[model samples]
Target: MKSTTLSRALLASSIALALAGCNSSNSNDGGGHTLPLEECKTYQSAPEVIVLSDNENIERQTITIGATGDMHGRIFAYDYALDSVDVNAGFTKISTLLSEERAQNPNMIMIDLGDTLQGNSAELFNDLPVHPVVDTMNFMDYDLWVPGNHEFDFERSFLDKNIQAFEQAVISSNIVWDKNSDACATNGEEVPFLPSYQIFEIDGAKVAVVGLTPSWVTNWQASSPQNFRNLDFKNELESVRKAVEDATAKHQPDVVIGALHWGRKDGGTGVHKIATELADYFDVLFMGHEHAQFIERVEKDGDYTADQLNISVRDADGRPQNQVEDKNISERYHSANRHESVKVIEPGSWGWALAKAEIELYKDADGKWQIFDTTLANRTVADIEEDAALQQEMQEIHDASVIDANTQIGTVDGNFTFTGHVSKFGGDEAVHEDPQFDGATNRLYTTIHHAKVADMPLVDFINQTQIRVIEEKATDHNGNPVKVDVSAAALFGDSSNLTDGQVYLKKDSANLYMYDNMLVATEISGEQLQNFMEWSYSYFNTYQEGDITVSFNKDIRAYNYDLFDGQGFTYEVDIAQEPGNRVTITSIRGTEFDKDATYVIAVNDYRFSSTMVPNGWVSEEDELWNSADETVYAIRDMLTEYVAETGTLSAGEFTNQNWHIVQYGQTDAEGNLVGDKGALLKARETEEGSKLWQQLQNKEICVVREESRDSDITIAVNYKDGSTWYENPQPGTYQGCVH
Candidate 1:
């Protein structure tokens, strides 16, 4: 059969229902051949018998598993947001890889680890009878699907429809219906919303695959609990162990696999923990969600911690090379003390690579099939051919998304950039006569580098837009009109910017926002606000007395460095001080700062959940209003609407030089850059200083990597780009200079 849809009722009833104890009451690509859209089924057939043993008594078979995860809706090779061809990743390219694997190893199992539904233009067809991504995967004959955390980003109804619409099985062991929830009544009994594990028989050998999703969806989607209503995400390790045990006891499978939608180490719960703790339970574990690629092996008796065993095996030579040894060699290998081990593999996200694991099974003298050896590798699609059939099938939707991205929504008078930083030496509008600088480029410095030192108009625009929307649409918890007192936002997309005098399109909004975050408003005390500010400013490292350049804390993500701006407040971050004491409120609506004062603030839903809730600065109950209650819920859509209605976006409207950094040695006791070191910092505005600054910034001149005041400084001119020319330079002349 090509592909057939399974009955939703039958599938739900077939799922294991023994996890009642964990219940809680909370609160693909293109078709080479065009397949009919309505049919949902896997074209997986019986394993092609490829014997690996020469001994008549021993019969061996190799099963290859082809898997993809964290695809993020990259079906075509084109990026709708950028209006450019994206050769780096695409499901259409991945389909070519999958087709080859299936032809070479007919016994292959195709799987998607999750985060496949949202991210690109594919989201435009979410309301279709079947999601375009799902339809594509079904057409590709994907056997099993795991629901990822991003899958909960939409409404429950949408998720329900997609789950039922998939031709194959959707499995996740950790997510269960809360028995205590009124929205999901299961006769006072907890029920698995989907099957926990799937058993597939290949050549009379049973293989069971258990799926586990990230259990922190509660905190990640705290702003929109309705999306995951009546569900409680259980502990990852506990759920997987229980599911594995149940699958083993019930089916006595020869192989047990884990399809986890968590990362290897970053997430508190990941395959690292699984490899170290549950190594003996599973034969192999495939993972996703971190958008990483690797293959690893952890011995059951080894003393390896999660960190040591959690490495991603990229090079093929780095892995063990003992697959399908001769019978004589196999006997010798069997005689040695061999410890049982679990194999872990993950395909990088967005269809960049395909993770393939070839497992060798052999029937021993007792006529019982036992796993003998395995090989694992990740095939990147850099040079892979795109499946022409898939491109032909998805052309219409892809073209429509491109047209929508280019459709004019509004106009911009100037550029709004996150990456472009005006250079002080060259002047913001200075044009270079050099051929290399042919583009309409003017940059004195990189804002990302100086973002900690000054307020950015790019960030200001996001915050101002958020504040405006909240003040216009949001209400207090009691449904009373509430004014926004403070607003904060972060720069997520490094290269995103608005062009000067361009007709802004939907893609412009997407490029500027870059995330699906909804707007959120919350009430907080002035003390809480100060604490939040301090935490944000902590992105900067402590400035030592003689430090010439300010460095950032490598541990902190740039996205966590939020810039706060509002009509009611002004603050300064003193890098001269320690992190906890860096921020001081200079003024509050032109009044003395009051730590006890109450105020309303605007932020994205992700910021509310990932930061405010974790810091105890705000709670779900403190929510003044959320965009989830409004028709235009997404921040990107809100930005598009605001621009479209205004007809033009003026940079002056968003510019707010409210917050600034106070450097250490360059400042007076009162924190002004008026000292000798401060003069050196401001020298860029002068003739000589500007010339030297430009040359240094452009690498026309560079300093030796190993330099010190105690030693002769070797200045290498054109160090990076051209022939090296050296000069002996005065040490203190260029000290404290901002590049």
Candidate 2:
């Protein structure tokens, strides 16, 4: 009953709702392989450093301990199907390591800190059994294990079942069980699981092992609230100190061992603080949480004052000193009072290794020595392997779910594995053969290029809504095909210095496909993406380049620089003989669009939620259409697909065209220079300044189709009519028109 409410204190109630209510009846005594777990409080001789009442004159002792973390169901059976996965391998590794150590001295005990469950691909399609993990742990002969935050990701009922399965002590110092509530309590009344701490003795040594877990586990784990109903995770170091104090005053234990799910030393603020601080109270800390290998003591060999006491234990936090702060272990040794300091150990996660400690008595009490009589014994490393018999027994249980590599969620055409950052958006030349660095050649370009590929794709959001354009699930694109969500940002800016007489590659004959555009390059995210968004509307001139007259409905955020005056674009009265396609403003949004009507955004869907465009956006009323989904293709994909099937791409060329740094105006039907045609032409011409111009003449290029078929097309031309030696009807000027 007490432990029930205590567990609730571990997390907020809202979180518990998602994880299922506390006290859900569920137990699987470890794959029907039940073992009688003994709770021992004594060893061969003497109470393992027995804690007596605080008579103000208690002898302090130094002890050794081992630790490991984040085994994550290595020994457990969350999913029983994969033949290659050694579910029970955790037991073999630890047991073997333990056997070898016991032959040497036998005071060492193995500790598992946290994350005993969740995070496996197979757990998705099967009813995960918590017992296999425990069975494996039991095989290793665990001294202590804590319920990690991941265990809470399951429902309260699952936690309950897992708790029942564990024959070992499952400590959660903060979680308090509620006795009054039948649901929270065990059966008719017996509450499930154990209290926070337990005392054990071995080799005539009395050690009190107290368990603790990170309080923040509630934030990430769903079942945290329900499983830990009414439980409270007190400040770790303080709680351990108090618990030790109480135990010493009552039972007089010699040493306090902390089996903490709480681990620090990572980038996180919470874990590191607890480990460094709580070190004072605990003689040995077997920690988990941030998965790291444990060392009885992390030594600084160079320049560090080994004997000097550090003002603060850790670099991250400066928590208030422990209640026994001022009480120095060294000073307490005068007369009957003995001296003792803390020893901490937190080992790595997973079933990778084992942490062990050996506590030895001081050689001479009267000798003046800054160093103690403790040292770290070598740790044990083991591989996760499969037990042949166990594997056979469980073979039928999971055979069907183990999917072949080829049959995994991929398209019939073949799995479209991501090549690199560059291939995703736009295009680059040459290195495309194998952008990934193959170790043989040590070229700096390949090394740097491959290094950038290590970045993972980020899941972006729009006003809290998941951008559904990115396909989250796997399915074949057949019959009426569904297009993958792919979008791009235009790089042209207001102050771009583009001009005419430029060249760009188009399909050689409008039939071949190509991705050889110079302006097109990936690294489309970060600064590049930001620059495009920031100056998105900067160069959008009307018929007149000098006209910098556009109304902003709201203050928009731009990425390149700040919202500068005139956006660095010095447009003048350079009027062209002909006009360019710039929309003439008549009336705008308020009266122009229907109040409740939806708008179709043709740009890389990101523009819908971004602030780059001054046009206030309306949500998609029904279904949004991207031409890639409607029998059309993005310029790059079309080329790739065309190449893949037809064995030939539409002919094209690569060239970096100039941009519109300044605007040029063109005369409209009113015979007046109404918009910036030169700036537009400048950008287009520069874009075509290379082999791209020749490719364009051969008529080979494809672009993302607008949502509407009638959307006016924007194309860049040579501005010079080609000299045709053939029929007069096939004019050379409009030959590369991208209609």
Candidate 3:
């Protein structure tokens, strides 16, 4: 079971490469070169073939199913630094584990659940003529594969080419070519992109493997609809039902297994609900998408009654009903039905683990194979030794990526550190004051303030790129070249904290990949613009008079924080105000605010697709431009080009301070301060006060302390409409300053 032994075992089998169809030419051909496109078009044209046979005389048979999903381009074992030790994970180790299992049972079948082509630096090889991951998968000899939603991240042509490179069967029951396209039709019916399912005859047992992908691919922000315009993603459950029925009628297999790219959560999709309702049809369900490891076993015996499973059932009104459980199968019964035993397993993402389902099948007197028992377990990569040969093979790809990542794109004059949030919270002082604030000091906060609350160099850089792109390609409704008046940007992911005065050489490109590569142009009214700012301000909790700290709402995600550039607008966020009323636009571009004016805005796809912001600020109808070129021009690339064009970059040239915060309260009838205004002001001067002051300085928040002898502790806040009073409040509760 050692990795060295596994490598030798794998090398001894010449059939691996031939079976995977990775060899360019036939094994008998001396060239051993990859076949040309004309000869390798086997995506859907190949029919199912029986590869193994089962002995009827044998009383029982066992099959091991090793499953992996969301590998995300991780080809080698990597050392992940945890709190105490380094944990290793990757396909290199997984290969050894799987090899040991296959050696024990030649009947073992390996499946990849999907989401394999995207996520890592190695994915850059996707555009290459021969993908490295394809080579690795062929080396590992995967039995079956399913396409995850991320597979559509690339154009149809690129995806199609990769599919043709796979030697094993690629199955997806729900994805089909456009029905109306006569070009892809066969006998007037739309042709499928891949086979729906494949029947594998392993030692005489006919096992049918069906694949299902998420239907929400069309709605994912990262996915471009135009890229998949030729395909349609059908409802998962309905597709599974149809595929199961078709496969059973055609093959009448001994067991049916599902390789689903959907996860357990609802997430605007009914994946979990559908999978539960149709549990009986699948002997084992291998799932992915959430990137979490889970194993569940559902069992039912002859003595078990349906009532036990229906106890928590709800009525149409969403209330618990006391009626007797119905035996007849209905949608409600289907929802509550767990009549048959089932087992579901999901391996964690990034090759951290593998899900193994071992099933024991018994041949009855009638010669029919039935599942006698089933067990599932998740094996972690941390527990296994890596395959040295596999690691050596992947090292070449990794070294190439490192070379590409370190290629000097441009240089910066000043340090562009990801300390925006930390600087706002007074850096180390904030963490020292309250340990709870430590979580906010991580990478998520580094660029939050720079991109969300205030104008910083990062947003300015992205905005400049967007503006340039929009000006070059965008047009108005009249077909006239349109100019973007304002640009919006957001920080998409975590990065290594960029140090001050550090030169951003080619080596720095890897850290900059988190921001999206494409830009989107859209139109927005002045009112919607204010609403967008208000949504950004909603990240903070209301500042009460007695509160010791100013903190962000725990419910808010750091990536959701966005800031606007291009327009010189000054706004104030009165934390004492209500959620939607927190942001007030005082002026725009040094002029009076006009609610009726419409402006062209450029933003990234992530911000453009966000629905968490209220008032429907970003709608598909308003989108005027999107980057859909065959060669992707991402924000990082733009930065590189900009830096190359202009020798040096400076934060001083890009940073803009147009917004601030005003913490005010109401005055009593006697014109005296009310509530805990005094106590809160005093707390702001304490060790906790460091973050408050830091935030005030970082946000340019103006605080006027008019020392008065008035006994009532209240603060007065002035508004464009009228003056209002704010009082002490608690967490999760807010009090509006009257307008």
Measured by lDDT, the strongest candidate is 1
**Model 1 C-alpha lDDT per residue in residues 1-739, reported as the tens digit of each score:** 1332323432222221111101011111111123322211222222212222234343777778778899888888766676766665788888898898888876688889999988875555544545667767876778888999988877665666676667777888888877777656567665776667887777777778899888878888898887787788888888888889898888888777889998766455567777677777787788998665556666664554434443342344532321221223122112122235677777777886788777778887788887776566677776677888877666655666776677787888654432233323111212211112111111222222333344555567788889888888776767888788889887664445554677887887776676778889999889999999889888776754333334556446667878898985777777768889988887777677889998888999988987899889988888888888675777777888888789998766776667656552232212234434332244444565566555655434333321111111122222122322222243222222221
Evaluated against the true structure, the overall lDDT of model 1 is: 0.65
lDDT of each: 0.65, 0.34, 0.57
- lDDT tens per residue, model 3, 595-667: 7888777766656664422248756778777665413355555565666667676656555555445542222
Model 2 residue-pair collision total: 107
Model 2 TM-score, 2 decimals: 0.44
TM-score of each: 0.78, 0.44, 0.70
Q: Choose 2 or 3, whichever is better by TM-score.
A: 3
Model 3: lDDT of residue 100: 82
Question: What is candidate 1's CA lDDT for residue 591?
Answer: 78
Candidate 2, residues 481-578: lDDT per residue as tens digits? 22222233232111111111211111111111111111111112222222332344332222332121111111222121111111111112212222
lDDT of 1 at 168: 71
Q: What is the lDDT of residue 487 in candidate 1?
A: 91
Give the clash count for each candidate: 11, 107, 22
